[model samples]
Every structure is written in structure tokens, then in C-alpha cells.
Target: MRKFFLAVSLVLTSFSVFAVNSSHCPHSCPSGTPSSNFVVFRAPYTLSNNATTKFADWVAYRIAPDTIQGGRSRNFRADPLLFSSRTLEPDDYTGAHAQIGTDRGHQAPLASLGAFSDFQALNYLSNITPQASGLNQGPWNILESRVRGLVQGGGFNEVFVQTGPLYEFFFAELPGANERHTVPSGYWKVIYTNVNGNIQTAAFIMEQTTPRSSNFCFHQVTIDEVEARAGLNLFPNLSGASTVERRTGFLRNDLGC
Candidate 1:
């Protein structure tokens, strides 16, 4: 078991390094941060409405930040138009106007963030994704909800998320744009926690826009894989955990998540 785990870990680690080094960014912005695993492009010039017509209460922004394995963090600023003296509805949005066929998908869901301050920061357009309706509301939403639930349930307080689509074909086209941008066929999310003398991290990868299927049918990969792809380690201290059992056991016993 020990030998098998070590071999698997080495393979994953190698792949991460290779993927990061090999990936290229053709259309990334000049000021944006680019990596093989992901790219942080500049936000749209204007704010748009939420994708779901169910709500129209929030505004958006664009930001760029460093990407770490299991998550990404950016210096986000909220739109003044969306703020209210009272709690704003998460589903509420102004309407999809500026960008045609581009749905204003929330990087941080309204349900997950209730505090006015938190919502204010998360509603920025930089964090939003121009995703398909099915992909935005389906598995992507589910995964966001799950992560929020975990945080609320004391899984972790300081959690960062960086997510985007993985276009399957090199020349695949976006749903509603004249120029083609990379359409993600899969999505990646990393979660990390430090609570009560415990430290834990998790990574999830799911199909981007599969219809009628569970939105977050994810496959777990090693922390090394995540770190390599994201180019930053989540648990820098746990470098010795070479096996899944060792890594997960440590999480269960320490973080209790």
C-alpha cells in the first residue's frame, strides 16, 4: 500500500508540473495573471444581470489575484448599485444587457454569502463567469452550494475559490460570441481549511456543461496535482502525505471536516 501510494503521488506530481509548464495563454489580458492551469482575464467593462431571471439584485466587478492549489484569491471590490441598507436577494440582478448570450454567473453564490459585506465583495464582475445557462446553474451551482455549506458548517472559515471552464476542443466556440474564447468542458475548484488545530484541503473537477446530470460529479485528485496545476501549494506543510489514506486521514482526524 505504501509503495503504491508513493508511485501514484509521484505520477500526479509529474503531471502537474508538465501541465503547468505546457499550457499557454493566447488571448489573456496584458495585466492579467496567466498560468497553465488557469487564466485570470480582466473583467468586462460593464456590469450585467444575473444569469437566472429569478433574481436581479446584485452587481458585479472584475479582479485578478494569485492562484493557489485548491483555491484562488483576488482583491475584489463590489458594485455600489447592488448594495442596499437591507439584505439584498441573492437571485436578484439588474438584467443581462451589456453582453449578449453571456449570463452573469456568480463566482460566489448569494446563498453562500449572507453578510452584506461578504456579498458586496463577491458580487464583483471579475469573479463572475460568462458561462452557459446549463453549466452556470447546474453542476457549477451545486458545487458552489456545497462549498458554502461546508464553510457554514464549520468546515473552514477562510476559503478561497478559483473556477473556470475547461474547453475540450482547441477550436471549440463559445455559445454566444463572435470571436471564439476557450469553452471549458470541465471545471476545477479547490477548498482549504484551518480550524481547531486541524488543516484540510480538497480539490474537485467536474464536467462543465453536461445536462440532466448531477452538476458536481467530481473526481478527487492528489493535492500535488492541484498544486502543480495551480502553481501553488495548498498545504505547504503536509509535503510528506504521499498517500490518499494518509492525507484524508489527517483531514478527518485533524480538521474533522
Candidate 2:
């Protein structure tokens, strides 16, 4: 049993040096990552953690009709696979909610994997980030729901979503954290699906101050633009420049943006 647990630990914290093997990602796990970022696979989603920020550099997951069920577990905890120096505990978010109007937002939302019994992995702090309450509850929350609608509404077989934070400018520190954990300046997301044998993609970048009622379409960007801002090579296994190039009005109508 001890050997089994040891092997499990090795598998869970598998370094990104190996190609990520998960059903959740689009083509392949994002490539061209920072040295500090390490990959950890959970039952529901896969994330690359950034030791510097004590947060994920990026998270990839797929949402299907059946996956979006059940209520939020909300049982946030530290990731056992990460070192305490590179991860946050529940106390790290103590005063943040009220003092800074920040939220312990899930990069891989729990609601998206509600159908799975082990969805608690989504609650791990390594998969959570300090996001402004307004942004987390407002446009960001809406966008997450929109992705689910695509799967539930039968508009797509499944929706592939990749998201991460942006540090374009200085950010505040989480008041409750004993260690330094800088808040993200903004966030980025890329949603993609196959339509008629062609890949259609939509991307967006939202600041921490995005209005709750903001129009989601107004923030639409290209995959390449998000790559530059977030320092990630998204969907590297997919071919064709059209998929990565900026599309001013790509999939706006389908997304109801």
C-alpha cells in the first residue's frame, strides 16, 4: 500500500517534461511554459502551477452535458502535491473576501465537474486564484455558464476551455496570506470547438475590474493575442495559422456575445 501511494504521488505531480495525457485538453496540453510552472493532473482538470505566484499558470478542461451538474463543494484546501512555499492554504484567503473584495475563484470551476464524485480536486488551492469578487461573480461567472450552455444546449458535443491569469501590471497582495501571493492583473480564456470539420475559436481577456454587466463580446481577442498576454502556447498540437490568428468577430454569434 505504501508503494502504491508513492507511485500515485509520482503520477499526480508528473512534470510537464512528459506530454500531458488527459481527455480534458484540446489537442495537447499547452506548450512553451515558464520554468517555474509544473503540471499536476486532477480527476476533473489539469493545471500548470506557477511557484512564483502560488497559482496556476494555466488550466485546461472539457465540459460536457453531464459534467455540469450538482452544487459547489466549496471545501477549499491546500494541494498536497505542492510544496507549502509554492501553494496557499485556506487561511491564505481569510481577509481577502471582505478587505480586498477578492474571491477564491476556481480556475477549473467546480460546477463544471459536478458530475464526478471526486470533484473535490477542483477545490484544491493550486487550482484556485485570487480574483476580484466583482470580476469573479460578474462577467467571468457569466462566461463560464455560457460555455456550459454550448454543451447543454446541444450546440456542441463538448466545449474545450483553457484559462489563466495575466500579470501585465503591478498587483496587490492577498491580505490574509502569510507569504507573498500577488493578485492577478487580469485573466484570459480561450474557448474552442469543432464546427463542420473546422476548428472555430473565441478568446477574451478581462481585467480585474470588468463590470458585472459588461458585454462579453467586446473583450474578444485572438488566440495569438491571448498567448502573448498570458505567455502560453495554447493548443500547440493543432495546425493551421487560422486557428491561432486573431479573428475580430470569430464565433461571436455562436457564443451569443
Candidate whose TM-score is highest: 2
lDDT of 1 by residue, 8-115 (tens): 434533443332110111111111112211221122212122222212211212211211122224333333333222122322223432433335565544444433
Tens digit of lDDT per residue, candidate 2, span 31-129? 766655667776688888877888888899888887887676688999877778878999988898888888899898888778877888888899899
Give candidate 2 regions above 4 Å deviation.
Answer: 1-18
Per-model root-mean-square deviation over C-alphas: 15.2, 2.4
Which number leads on lDDT?
2
**How many residue pairs clash per model?**
20, 0
Q: After superposition, how far is residue 70 of candidate 1 from its true place, in Å?
A: 24
Model-by-model lDDT, in order? 0.38, 0.80
TM-scores for every predicted model: 0.47, 0.91
